[model samples]
Target chain A: MPGAETPIETIISMMVGRTLSNDALVIPDTASQPVALEVRNLNRGREIRDVSFAVRKGEILGFAGLMGAGRTEVARAIFGADRRESGDIFVHGQRVSISTPKDAVAAGIGYLSEDRKHFGLATGLDVRNNVALASLERFTSPIGVLDEAGMQREAVSYIRQLAIKTPSDTQEARLLSGGNQQKVVIAKWLLRDCDILIFDEPTRGIDVGAKSEIYKLLNALAAQGKAIIVISSELPEVLRLSHRIAVMCEGRLTGILPGGASQEEIMGLATLREPAMAVRHAS
Target chain B: MTDTTAPAPAAKTGPRISGAFHRLLAFSGLIALIVAFSLASPNFLQTQNILAILQATSVNGVLAIAATLVIITGGIDLSVGTLMTFCAVVAGVILTYWGLPLPVGILGAILAGAASGLVSGTIIAKLKVPPFIATLGMMLILKGLSLVISGTKPIYFNDTPGFNQIALGSFIGQIFPAVPLPNGVLVLFAVALIAAFVLSKTALGRYTFALGSNEEAVRLSGVNIDRWKIAVYSVTGAICGVAGLLIASRLNSAQPALGQGYELDAIAAVVIGGTSLSGGRGTVLGTLIGALIISVLANGLRILSVAQEWQTVVTGCIIILAVYADILRRRAL
Candidate 1:
């Protein structure tokens, strides 16, 4: 354990002593066993050196950083809504290429985008339809006829499962409150059997009571061994919810730390930029 | 400050009064027209005048019902007018030139309208063109096609001797000789009843409102919005086909020039009857009332010796007033 810090401490002390170039901090493997998702050497050929990380099953891996940190970009990349110039992504130890949101779903990956109102739901549909949308195949017959009764029964289960406060499944989504909308989004992914979940800015505008419920839901989902990755701007949220925390700065992974790590430690790594070191490599 | 909430008697009475007011307005409009027209001209009270009004409403009312479906989906079908005309021309071609059976001619006519609607729907849905642009293009296309097909002349349905009877004949009148209501009126009512039922009771109907209400929400819900949008246009098209049959039968000919302006009248009737052009809220009953209002106004104004140009101007003004009134009501809500 002491030996682990020796190299890092030596590097820091060397930089402090010589006031040398703020670069060449050797990085170590941050991923753990039973990898849920792994990105290895993503876009290594570009100006921005490709980095890698892994999320373990049943763990809340919180991603925290300041603005322009590429935290949301990483989440979007994994969700397949954004392109990775070159990277090998493995879901449940199986390498996969996801080019679109539909592909991500097919791989049992569910993404709750930051902008839930626009991308996550069809606001005009009733509660039941939004819940059943991603799983329409289960509700329709071979001949393309909708089984209304079957769909309704399944919807009732989700409404009960999510404890969605609505008169019935027929209540339109637009009529529901913000928290209810978030729950509906969760219910959609849950219905789709998505084991790997990416939640970005999960409680951005949700009220206090609803935020508590969402935290509880995330904990519950993690307890069930779902690979959960949360992207957040809130410090307390990242500190409290994560089992491990990953810090990003300037579109690069600055460092990874245990969840119990202090805000100062995370911020120190986030602001740890090696400007001349990157420039030195260029020369 | 202490009164957090209180239901005043007057506040509670408002909704009931409003409901009653609308019904009263429509019912009274119909009655007042009948009474006034009957008093002004003895000829107006005659069964012939009554039948004539009903007959006039049949075609426009049916088209309005079709337009109601499209408008409710937050879309419009401007081509419905020429599409109807094109359908009639097809029917005329089938009956008079191709020498097909009367039933076949009717079938051909309806299918022709539906096919055009399907094309418009495809252009709008699959091509990602807005409904206005797609349907506007379709309107012109159908107009040109009709004129070219008919060679800028009316095609008489003389070869199919019984074709005119489809509209002018009165089976219901024969059964109940006291009323003598034409079969065309009955057909119109039958179509309206069925359209209303489909809109209210079917999954397609619910989605129609859903599309107008929030199309993206519907798509996120995993509905094939393109397919549903196409279905709506196709249904509207099929109804247009029905309107074409009624019109051609009524005139005993397919007049290409007659359909170039009918869409405005149908749309006006729908709006006047209380259907919102923005979609999400509408009723077949409203379209019926709207159709009757236009017919009564025209019949009454003609009796009052209003010039034809003045009648057109009055109709235009009424459309604006009706739309403005709707805006006021929405703002009040």
Candidate 2:
């Protein structure tokens, strides 16, 4: 039912179902419509040109592109990891400006950065501390008082839930393997209650077993009606996990189609940028 | 969303219990030294000799603790000696020149040290200069300023004769009056305790370790590494301010030319105490012990009638050995 999206023209007539609020706007039509997220003329500029699409709840929005093809930029811009010059982003039809990562977190958007070792963790801190870092306010009193016991318990729960290979939450994050570190990243986002999750190269550098575990987690998160965007350089991954695929090339959106679209069609759109732009220039 | 998860206990690898025991082995060398020294001389075990050693270590130990924080952050401060002297001179100016109260003079000394340290942090963090070079320049500037401020002469606290009581007055000894330990020893311990608290607790302390571990990693995590680095330098500088107060208090005068080579001694104490100069691994207790080691060596040698020049050579050897031990430990880690 979320998959059958009537275009924005229909949504305009459905304004009677919208509720006004200060920071959060709840649209009655979009709320009950089963679509977790919808982007109407989502313009991220230079890289993403007049790109528009609708992704139903619990469906993965797979962004596929070659290296430096603006796919990573899209993830970054939407997650508020990087500021976009101009764009309209909505979580459940509530328009939001994500100027900073803190803002994104408050808006229930979580971004898993590709560079996990550097951006994702404080290695000196134990695994438990790293997991509790993002949502530290929840575990801490206003005056910088950290409830070590509560934090430790929460960390242990995440570790068990994720099946991470850690001796304990007390073990330093520095000592963990690559796959375990990625698990810690996922646990961090989940603790923050992020409804819209973005994973950039989620399985990069992970071994086969760990990759399977991550895929399983992604699938499970989707089943719970979380809006997911996965940007991967790997074609097979895009094919396997994506509900819909958006192919990009040379910093511009070339095509969008269902996940079942043939690789040949996506490849055709990926190479569409230069020839079409060159032709336009000549004209 | 899945909750069915087991807390997989980490598999044991290396000998856990032995590693901790090995860390406790730093005292073995000191024990051997004590046994050898006691056998060589009767006075080596005397209370007078012990007090003398502690008093001698008081200045260097305080300076060492200051250096330990910087060293732990993978940084070195070459200007500590001159910075200490500059602090003393500033206090001297406040006490004698402007006729300020004793407390103001003490505060002035520390503030002077902090101001210069702030400059060093700014140059290194904002201007992107290496810590070694930036602090080296600061050392020279402060050294020159000490002379200029004091007109190449000693500034005595003779006008406020009671000023000597800060470090010279042994409040602990007076309470007991049996040992009559100098107040300087108490100051050294207090400084060490405070430094330990700062290094082990607080957010600034965390970032200090993080900056030394991987600075860019910290920056990418959205932490303002620059501000923290500056704070580290300021803390180090504030400690130097304390050192200046102690030195000036002990000498009873702010000698313009007195603080030339103290930085080397402070760094030596830090290294000998087991703080890795390469950063990311250090402890305040290690630095305290390191200061004691330097002073004990000096005192033991003095009691054995070792020449002043030989004492310098032995200290140099110990410093090299200490740093080499650090390198080996780092490689092993």
Candidate 3:
């Protein structure tokens, strides 16, 4: 019982120390089983620091933080939108190197950005094209021509399944409401069969009706055994939708709280910050 | 923000309706120009003058189509004019200087142009240089290279017999004697049609629009944006090579000084054709019509004895008006 009796704080500090170097810290194989995604001491220069957490399949993990607290940066690093200085990312218990969004998508992770206008949807394209944007590889022939019929059929099915209230599949994405646009982006990643989706500010600009729809969609996705990480600045929304909550402050994970925690409890964790260890290490 | 009066389904037809409306407006503007020009000069309506206009549009039209592809990817190619000249000089070296076959010259020109575009694309995509600055550098570099290679003088293809036939000869003219449409115009038509088909039907075209619309979105979608960007520029460059072939065959020479202002003209035509300079939306047919409008205006003004300086002034004003029209349309949307 000597090794088994190591304190949790000691294990965490070991992870923090090992993260400063390039070595992947050994993860304890426990009876609980590994989650869909597990990050140990993920470091990205100054932007992200010793950030580590886990979200299992069929669970919604809410990430709550103040602006510039590195919640988005952590998500970007995990999804490979940004480069990490050191860390290990395990997707479904397999250590994976994701250096770009392309790698992340191939690894079955989808990210819905906070800024939908610029980073989430191509506003000028039709709904079908937007939905098919991530999945074009599936609809392409050997000669590099797109299979229009197949794309349309799949898009139409998603539209019906997701209840995207567009008039038809050919409707342009920009014309759709904020919620519909978000739905189209959801449909896009869903059709691509991404097992883990990171929704950053999922209902930011959506109307009340569409916000509820998105919540329902997220619930449905989770029900289907997909892992979801919702990054929301809104405490109430996060508490309502998440099964568990991870809080960050000044680029570090302060604590992971249980679901339905009071706003004050989450805020207390979110404001908890330690002195910048990255600067100390740099000097 | 809480206004729920507008249902989602009703707004669905808005894009298609507005698209058709904009195209119709541009087409009517083209028609208006034609009507105005015909009223100004009787000779403008003549078949000879119309053919001349089409011949004039051939080079610029092809170049405009090339520019359209680049612009659709939210990028630009200012080097297209000099790149076209570079292609022509490469062709001259292969055909006239080396005494090689015509096909070799054609292929050489296209390959050289594509190579130049690849370099420019790498600068833009890999180096993260903005398209305008990168293409501008490429323009100056290519222009200097063309001048240096051609010995700072025209590379004349006069010794190459039947070279002019590539542009001037017309099979359609043989079929219908009265039409007398040049092969240059036919080449422009062929290029436009193929470009249109590619833009609408192929994965490349889809990515082109995707890149222009939201490059970050496309990149995040797991597409290799850099590779597609390079491919788009290469296609644009190869098309510029075709334009080079057209101009060189027509003039029987590659004049080093003739290409500097052509980039502006091609960009102007693209903007006038309703293709947004910011990228994301365009059509080959719009570009063809835009090129025709420029040529027709130039030809008609010449027939009316209007001064060249005034003609330039009018064209500049037209470009401003076209962009203003675009702004108005987008604002309304």
Q: Compared to the true structure, candidate 3 yields what TM-score?
A: 0.91
Clashing pairs in 3: none
How would the candidate models be sorted by DockQ, starting from the highest? 3, 2, 1
Q: Would you list the clashing residue pairs of candidate 2?
A: A47-A251, A167-B10
- i-RMS of candidate 3: 9.1
lDDT of 3 by residue, B1-333 (tens): 112222354563555666656667778888998899889888889888888889999999999999999998989999999999999998988888798988898899989988988898999999999999999999999899988888888888877877787789887999999888999999999999999988998899999999999999998888889999999999999999999999999989888777888999999899888898888998888888788778877887888899998888989998898888878887787
TM-score of each: 0.76, 0.81, 0.91
Q: What is the C-alpha RMSD of each candidate to the true structure, in Å?
A: 10.7, 9.7, 10.1
- Residues B70-119 of candidate 2 have per-residue lDDT tens digits of 88888889999899999999999999999999889888887787788889
Q: What share of the true interface contacts does candidate 2 keep?
A: 0.15
Best candidate according to lDDT: 3
B188 Cα displacement, candidate 3 (Å): 0.1
Q: Model 2 misses residue B228 by how many Å?
A: 2.8
**Candidate topping TM-score:** 3
Q: In candidate 2, what are the lDDT values of residues A1-283, reduced to their tens digit?
A: 2245775434433442332111111111222335555555545657655555555677788888888888777777665666676667777778776676667777787777787876777666678867866765676555445567887898999888888888788777777776788889888888988877888899887754456567768877877777788889887677777777888887777788677677788778777768767899789
Native contacts, share recovered per candidate? 0.15, 0.15, 0.60
